[model samples]
Target: MTAQTTDTVLYRGEDYDLIGLIAAEPITPQDFGMTPAMISTACYRGYFCTYAIEDDRLFLVEMTLRERDGRYLPIGGIQPVADAREATCSYKDLRIPVDYTGSLRLASGFVRECYIHMGYQKASAFETVLDFSLDAGRIVRVHDRSAEAARKRGAFKKHFEENVAWGIQESFDLDMDIW
Candidate 1:
């Protein structure tokens, strides 16, 4: 597993990297009759999504996919297109409302010390963690758990430094065999 690219979320006029899987309405490349090709190791999922929280509602703002020719193309949102291949739309248009009523974990200010090599990082790897509750895509509540995350990170760092011989390395490269 490689370092996967993160999905973006615009919340309260600020963009934050989504920490974990979004438990929203499932929308895939196959739904649009396209098989996206992976263009780089950083994007193992072959696609990435951009979301926005406007007026307390969650919207799927954009979806980008890698073509076989290695060119990244927009597949959904932000445009009036007849099909997925012709997805050239402006940023202001085409906000697909997501019917998601669940909790969302968003993170920012990545902590380099807690870096993991494979897949989406855990919430603890960030300096700030925001837990959001939604009802049918509308944001119902928000909780900032930055201090708790910081405390957990500190404890992990202390344990690692005291036990592991490699003292406080900036990054930890995991063995591919573990995958």
Candidate 2:
């Protein structure tokens, strides 16, 4: 859709459903850590899923909940964003970590993982895995290769990325606190 179009799916989320949530903000070039010309916005919906567009690309962060007075509070802004320290994979040169407790799962039973930070020297990375079927080509042999931190990190990233993504998409309990 054109940026000027009023009807759009990629909205900044400032409607009635997003009243209490934080509105999308500009992610300046400095926010991306490379160029000073790139720009994006951090948008929220019903206190969930903060995302932005940087140079026409969609970027998201991992969301986590912290216990506060018997309640779980979201840590990475209104929607979830990725944390660099949580998990990572070795396949990529930069080794982007998985967002939101490591990994997220999809309704199709596919696992999705994210890594790297927006502020990193390079673009972030993502992976999709198929765990339910042996025929799926996404499966990797990590049990023995995960001796290094990178291998272990990649495996964990895939595992949880699938779970969280699935939970969010299905509205069920792979991850409850964030979705």
Error of 2 at 48 (Å): 3.9
- The stretch of ten residues in a row with the least summed lDDT in candidate 2 is 1-10
lDDT of 2 at 79: 25
Clash number for every model? 1, 27
**Tens digits of per-residue lDDT for model 1 on 36-100?**
67646777556667889899888877776654544333435333233345332223354778768
Q: What is the Cα-based lDDT of residue 171 in candidate 2?
A: 29
Which residue pairs in model 1 clash with each other? 79-89
Q: Candidate 1: RMSD over Cα atoms? A: 7.3
**Residue 92, candidate 1: C-alpha displacement in angstroms:** 8.3
Tell me the spans in candidate 1 whose CA falls farther than 4 Å from its real position: 22-26, 31-33, 67-93, 154-179
Q: Which candidate number would show the highest TM-score if scored against the true structure?
A: 1
Candidate 2 has an lDDT of 0.22
Error of 2 at 41 (Å): 27
lDDT of 2 by residue, 1-179 (tens): 01110101122332111111111221221222222211122211111222322232334432222111223323222322333453211111111121211221211111224331111110011121111111111212212111232233344334445675542333212221211
